[model samples]
Target chain A: MKEIVVVSGKGGAGKSTITAGLSYFLKENDILVDADVDAPNLKILLEPELIREEDFYSGKQFKIEQDFCIMCGRCYQECSFEAIEIVNLNYVIDDVACEGCGLCQFLCPVNAISVSDKLTGKKYVSKTKYGFNMVHALLNPSEENSGKLVAEIKKIAKNLAKEQNSSTIIVDGPPGIGCSTISAISGSDILLLVAESTISGLHDMERLIELTKNFKVKRKGFINKFGLNHSIDEKLVNLFESKEIEIVGYLTYSQNIPQYLKKRVNLPEHIDGYKKLFEGLYNRLMEAVG
Target chain B: MNISIVSGKGGAGKTTFTILFAKYLVSKGKKVLINDLDVEEPNVNLFLNKKLDYDEVYIYIPEHIKENCISCKECAEKCLFNALVVAKDFWLVLPELCHSCKLCEYVCKYSAIKGSKRVIGKIGQSFDKMLHLLEGRLNIGESLTTALIKQVIGKSLKIKDNYDVIIMDSPPGTSCPVIQASKDADKIIVVAEDTPFGFSDFVVLSDMLKEIGKDYYLVINKYIDGEGYSEFASKNNVKVLGKIPYDINLAKNYSFGDVEDIDTIDFDNIYNTLLEG
Candidate 1:
């Protein structure tokens, strides 16, 4: 099966809107993955029904056995992270502060500290109204290992696609050029970059484009809110042409989007021209992916 | 005092605010040290038109000595991250997956395993009269950001007590890096816009700060261009430090590296409120 990832350098660039519309346009049984584990909103638009949920754990946490504690204060001093703190008379480990580096566990003369797995987040597999599978996750607040969660979500999507004999997988990736974005784009057949028309937007897009090039993935560009600045839009078009990246389409500023977002409804149905625009974009994307 | 300019979401003017804040402090005759903790994309240096002086930060990972190796497979079994793959003749280590826990070395029965250091990223520092900007740049294709952030923050700690005010520009999201940067702060100013996205992320960030026991104030940016953020702030009982109206000239000048005068605008009031808070 082929996969396409939709990513933007900055937030609020209509990445989820486009992903939801495309998911609606794709044939039934296709898979949709929301790799934005932090603050995932694709389900709000797609309105997926819960099918299954599983807890995911990436790293371990250090726990000290109080009975064996000697109040040596060695763990506090040796910990590179100030995960340990003195509460009352006993030392306690702040699970959030603890990096699970094992230095405290190894250095404890009393062998009081031990590492155990902690739940980081939960992943969901659901059935959307469009008759497709949706795989997404919500990382716990102040949790780490988002990139690992992204990988797990994609793995589940791939397995679901195989089990259902689906032919395509579309992913709504997170913003920023971080480990999570890299995990979402890795091994993808195509990447759709949705960039805004602002100076900082252009600069962030440059960094994201450089990042995508490192993975050697085929890329296409779309200028979201093209009406923000006409000159910047022209400059972006030229930049795409110079880089040999195709400018698939442009989306002008529209209140209909935020309206749909507020109501948690799909765009194509609520907006007047969004359906046609997305249908055409979907067809073109299929052709390009082929 | 160490102050951090942070937002829960990306592109919310963290770097822009840092530069302008540095210029404002310099004009006020206060020495400032700006540390950019957004190691994944260190763009503060780019805006300043200065190259970073790089110093390597190393992380230890297990390496097997072939001569002393035993085919026991104990190291692989003890590895929780699945970083060690035991083969018939030897074991292979996946450096990226390794959390540098040193468990493989401890579990080795043959004394074959040894820990070695690898440079995951570098700490870069540059200085002006009023500002000493330090940034950590994680090497491309490297996934270990928390380690690099720790190194950068550790190095900055030595000189942080000297400066009158050390301003830190943190990475987006309430993850490990954000916690690391905000851990030692005297106070935090969360810069957010008046939008659903901004408000939602602000709640998440506020919860994080409260859990970590840090004192914080909120600044609603682009308030003149929109509304709703104030309502959210009031309903949540988040202290309002200040507000910056939506101004194209301010944004343009900031993008071009000309620090717009915060005193000429309402930002000075915002800074004063934060200082008071």
Candidate 2:
């Protein structure tokens, strides 16, 4: 079995676009994983039919009960996050800022604090329109612990792949070199970085490459929207080569992307050069992973 | 007042629109401070082309004193983040996993843990006396995005008196870091697009803004002909701010130094409208 995670350090660098295209092209008993919990958009492209949805509990949130409060303000003073604030003569914890350290709960003089399991996110298993199983997640907006959610969804995808007796899982990763990106690509066999040919793209790509350098995974680079600037494109190619990452494919700029985006269509499969681009990438990826 | 430019999706031109407003405010004889809270990869200085002086943001990760340790694993057992891996002889601290909550240091019975600061990111400051840009760039392989963002906010707040307006460019996704940046803003301008993914995510984003009690305006970036962005904004009960047209020439030339013609986006009224209210 092989798992290939597509990541781009910068968002909107065509990570999901490329992953959806590649997954649709290789719709042969492969399990698709959408690990962008904060903004999971793969289902929009694939129109996945939900099979099951489950609540995900990652951490506990501490809340102060106003009824039992004496309002000593000790928690407000001791909190590092400043999550506790005086509200209507009672201290309240801002869930967004609260680090869930439990220090405030321990310090409350009247013991007005209570801890409860936080519903951090939700996990879903579904069947894509392409007849392949898909595992995805959606983190509650303004929630933390996305890395944990990504790891959980990846595990579910792996388990589903095992049950379906599939050998390949195409994981759509999120942006930023943060916990979610790390979790998505950590154990994957092949890491395909889909990057654009722009200065911001190049700079962030270098950081993403640096982040994944310690992991023992075969790395591949695909410069999506390449050929925009010859110099920038060339620089990206050199950066990829210097990292010893195989240059699997180069997708030139295509107007079909935004036009199809207007038509609410993802996976620019019918564009002039997309078929060749994705075919070359898929072939190179399989060979490299094998 | 501080305004945060945020987006549900990436490449919605959040930075582009922010620069337009900041530059426009400066042209109007108003002082502006721009804080790039997109710490994972802060590139505001790239477009401004300014030589910035940077200060490192320190995050305290525990430094274990192995000699003072009893292998009781109390520190490891009490860690909420599981950052401490208690080996057969010593405890290993995975700096990436550490949330810097000071819980491990608090629980160490043998005084085995010491507080230490590591550079997780850098805040770059640049200005031309009228417009100041604070670029918060997270160090490579670091996931302490919210910590750096808070630091950037802190640094920018100290200089808030110098500027007539403070504009923050927030990171993508409706996550904790976004909330951290959004909570401090007087107004949040959500730069979105005219696609299903973009519109749906904007809806989700507005729900978050409501939960955080923030008033937001929608600016559909890359506005094209026959897109239902205005309709979507109205349906969602969001105020339409302004739209930056889709121009390939502008995108091609975006790599060059400073932006010159931000008025083409027709954002002259937003400054007064958002400020006066």
Q: What DockQ values do the models have?
A: 0.29, 0.62
Mind sharing the TM-score for model 2?
Answer: 0.95
Per-residue lDDT value at B159 in model 2:
90
Note the residue pairs that clash in candidate 1: none
Model 1, A64-84: lDDT tens digits are: 889999999988886756779
Worst 10 residues of 1 chain A by lDDT: A254-263
List candidate 2 segments past 4 Å from native: A266-273, B65-70, B87-89, B108-112, B226-228, B255-258
When summed lDDT is taken over every stretch of 10 residues in candidate 1 chain B, the lowest stretch is: B251-260
Query: How much lDDT does candidate 1 score?
Result: 0.78
Q: Which portions of model 1 show Cα errors greater than 4 Å? A: A9-14, A43-51, A71-82, A101-111, A126-133, A163-165, A214-216, A225-243, A252-276, B109-111, B224-228, B246-259, B262-265
lDDT of 1 by residue, B1-277 (tens): 7887777766666777777777777778889888888887676875676656778889988888998886788788767678899888967999888878676787677889997999988888775556788888777668888888878888889887667888888887787778888988887988875555566667778888888888677777655433566676677777877666656666555434454666444556756876777
